[model samples]
Target: MKKSLPKYFRRFLLACAILLALFGLSRLYFRLTDDFRLSNITYKMPYRQAWEVPEMSEAQRENFNEILNQKFYYVGKGAQSYAFKSEDDKYILKFFKFKHLKPSFFVDLLPSVGAFKIYKEKQVERKNRLLNSVFDGYRLAYAIHGDETGLIYIHLNKSHELNKVVTVHDKIGLVRHIDLDEVPFILQEKAKTTRTVMTELMNNQDISMVQKRIKQIFDLYLLEYSKGIYDRDHGVMHNTGFVGDKPIHLDVGKLTEDDRIKSKEFYKPDLLRIVSKFNIWFKANYPQDYPTLKAFMDEQMQLIFEDERV
Candidate 1:
């Protein structure tokens, strides 16, 4: 009996060892074969060198002018900006000057700093694509080319005046005209006015108007956050305003992905703060509108939280 007990114990030990080995082998296989590329793909700037504006070939120059001529509306300039219409007539372009590239001495770090601006452009592209897919009629705004330099020539025939058609200032670059009346109100302003305008709109009491605007604004931010867009210095909530009865999103530079997704500082706290302030402001100024806006925000946040879970 004792000898048979030892044999059975040996068999049990051997079976356990085989099972663990098989499990480890399966895990290793998956670790190697699964879609790990996304995890490994780090965004590093090309090692060649710092980007310099490439000289335009003759063909490239012609194509560039053709693209500009075919698309774009000319909006009037602000102190440091020149606006244009996007090809689709759905977005406005704000070109920044070289002087606007002042470094943030405190937070500027490597890898992230080099990738920041480009990441922002990519983020806008992702958000626009996602929103346009999820919301049937919604079209999120986008930033066009970040930086390009070249000599621009204007041909004014007898029918058109060069000055009236296009204004070419050395410092400001070229300003071309296209239809932009339908653009969101927020897109037309400097960054400083974004929060104030949003707060004012939230405080308006008209139920129908509040509902429409709140939906637009909420969708706008949802699109922004889902695409992993975050601007550390500016703190998300870029620009806002209405286009007709609907709200619009604008000024989407400085967006990027970060490890802070797990931190409350990233989304929850900031979102709560924005909503709380908005509610307070709404209650004080337009007591009648406060409930509608509050309800809209509550529903929107619920949707956001569900999406985050998935």
Candidate 2:
């Protein structure tokens, strides 16, 4: 009887091992067969352009060039602005200019900057991991590189077109000219258009259509927020037509370690801010759209706070 007991125990252990192996193999098969290619998505790189530095004297330009030459990239100027591109085609660079930096400022900002970089790296890893974990139907933006530097150069001529250049920057916070054009319309025009179109529809007593449209917008915002792919501000910007459809949370340069966790205090103010903007826009341009807007807000609140339980 004791010998038979040993035999049974060994069989049970063997069965458990087989089951575990099969489960792992199934997981691997699913991952391999998944249609989404998270690894292959290409982020938009800033294009390089030449900027005329009429403001700087020739001596200053020579000095600036000497300083910039130490780095591998060259600064170029274009029709309206300047940009930095790598000389060796290794990386795209953007320059952040500061007038004067005090010791206190550096002391305060350095830690935050380091934390932001770490958080950004973690977020990028999380994005890649989540792409394989579930079919959430959302893609998170990845930041390839970012840094702070005092001076940036722009070329004197438009030898390379916008798309081929390695680095580009705009005062409006766009990486490209196309994004610049789309951003203003997204931030200012789309929201107004949506409100106007909905209001006109509502005024004609098309309550059903108004509800449907509002719900659609609210759902999009909720989905964007849930994925952690966008902030509430950009969500509003995107919803209202302030920015392009592309997610804009890549400035993880400002992200804190606490931001990774679910914090109501952190997210609530931004959410309310967006709602306020929507309210102001609707009230000013289309008072008749208020009812639908309110319904949409309520739906967003429920979706954000209740349904997702975020």
Candidate 3:
């Protein structure tokens, strides 16, 4: 305060302050009005029947129904969904996040200048596109790679008939009673992430056993590639998981049906993107095992690239 700032600098600071205040107020308003009940959700699988998968037999339906009746423990939340693991540890239910479903009414209040309107329209379009993409991806995964994806069922609308409820115990020790009848969720077979599984294997199992498991995961990836299914989200670590000995794509939202992914040129780079990170981590943490595993992986990759069967 000893020396006053220049006029333009002061103006810029004042503008920044105003913007910050507006942002704070907007956040507060959203927090205050946050509706946990999700009563105002707009999309509801409009034309499609709620349960359209005719492939599910009566026994499978009964099994799913029995599982739904049990209480579930809360798993971590992601950008798109809030995940919960079943009491029996056999299933996972991912309820779509409220933030993704909620409408942004502020966009409606903006004046309709040509550029502004177009901008707002594009935002809305993008939001819808993301929502649709996730739903469509799940459906496609279930249809094409159900075993690999562990996708059991997709519930896209509110219904009293289902009346599925769960008791969730979160990380903070808070208990939440949620009615799945109101929540849009995907039911899937439970799995541990690839990173977690791999770490445990490295710590507990012999190098040969670890190599076998890793090769199985690579084979699974190659199989999916052969089927023309590609996971847009690098399906190596977080997005991929192990259900027993089989590696499955856990994050099904970003899967895309691209035949080009079958080509070795496109596949190698995608494979390396995650493996290169692992290679560095292995060298630093378990230096003795690194060279052996690295050479093994290189040989396997070369074999994969050379094999015309994909």
User: Best-fitting candidate, measured by lDDT?
Assistant: 3
Regions of model 3 farther than 4 Å from truth: 1-45, 48-52, 101-105, 108-114, 157-163, 166-181, 307-310
Deviating ranges (above 4 Å) for candidate 1: 1-67, 70-80, 84-91, 102-206, 232-238, 241-248, 259-266, 306-310
Residue 45 error for model 2, in Å?
Answer: 13
Candidate 3 local lDDT, 1-310, one digit each (tens): 4988899999999999999999999888655433233343224445456234454578977887898778777666776776779888999988786467443677767767889889788777877778777777787788889999888887665666665566766545557677766667789999988778778878985788778867877877788888888777764767878898777888888878889888878877777765676677678878988999899888887787776432
Give the whole-model CA lDDT for all candidates, comma-separated: 0.42, 0.38, 0.75
Q: List the residue pairs that clash in candidate 3.
A: none
Candidate 2 C-alpha lDDT tens digits along 231-251: 422434323311122222212
Ranking by lDDT: 3, 1, 2
Lowest-lDDT window of 10 residues in candidate 3? 33-42
lDDT of 1 by residue, 78-177 (tens): 4323455545454444443212222322323424455675665555466444322321111112221121101122111111111122222222233423
Instruction: Output the better candidate (2/3) by lDDT.
Output: 3
Cα deviation at 177, candidate 3, in Å, is 5.1
TM-score of each: 0.39, 0.31, 0.77
